[model samples]
Target: MSRVKFELPADDLTRATAFYREVFGWETQRLPFEYVLVDTDGEPVDPADADGGISPRTRFVQGPVLIIEVPDVDEVAGKVAAAGGELLNAKERVGEYGFSQYVKDSEGTVLCLWQSIADGTAAV
Candidate 1:
């Protein structure tokens, strides 16, 4: 099964959150950042599932972005442009869990590539 991380862009998170809860029956948890995680499943937000987040729409990121797990972000980051895609940012650490990068696909849809560290707790 492929692991996916998704992000939803919202102008007002509180209102958007209500919609997610009432319409989709999903719960949300707010992180330290302005980001809110949407638990599509009633269970804890498992990494194996399509864990998603919602945040205020940004200037560059106005639409939803989907993330796919990769073995090596740097390796994949190198091939984006040749594939007619654009790397929006360089790979960066997510605390001690993993690294992520945002890239725009050939048709301009922004996506993320994630590479997790097996020994997750060690800081890079």
Candidate 2:
């Protein structure tokens, strides 16, 4: 299994975090520097079995952004572009927080690539 996950980037981590906390009532865990983790509870989901009990109506779970834990942001950036995706931003340090970049998928939908330098782990 691939350790992939999705992350929603913000121009201002503090402000975005606060806005989400108040508006969505989400729990935020401050990591090193300005990086923070939005706490969420994951539950089993099956679109085909919507009538089953695993649905949200039956099992209440926190459905957050689908974060893909990638390996190399730089390499993936190339793959993304070559695969019909466009690089919106080059890989750069996220201040003292970590490293991040942006890209637009084939459909022109922008997304973020997250990398945690502290632990040497990455996500995109």
TM-score of each: 0.78, 0.53
In the order shown, what is each candidate's alpha-carbon RMSD?
2.6, 11.4
Pull out the clashing pairs in model 1. none
lDDT of residue 79 for candidate 1 = 85
lDDT of 2 by residue, 1-124 (tens): 2244445545566777677667856666655454556544322322211111111110111222333334567877888899999887668775544566767779866655655555535442
lDDT of 2: 0.53
**Tens digits of per-residue lDDT for model 1, 1-124:** 4477788899998898898989988878766666677888866654434378787897656888887888888777788878889999877886545787889889988888877777765344
Best by lDDT: 1
Top-TM-score candidate index: 1
Query: lDDT of model 1 at residue 43?
Result: 60
Q: In model 1, where do residues sit more than 4 Å from their true spots?
A: 47-50, 121-124
State candidate 2's TM-score.
Answer: 0.53
Which 10 consecutive positions of candidate 1 have the poorest summed lDDT?
A: 42-51
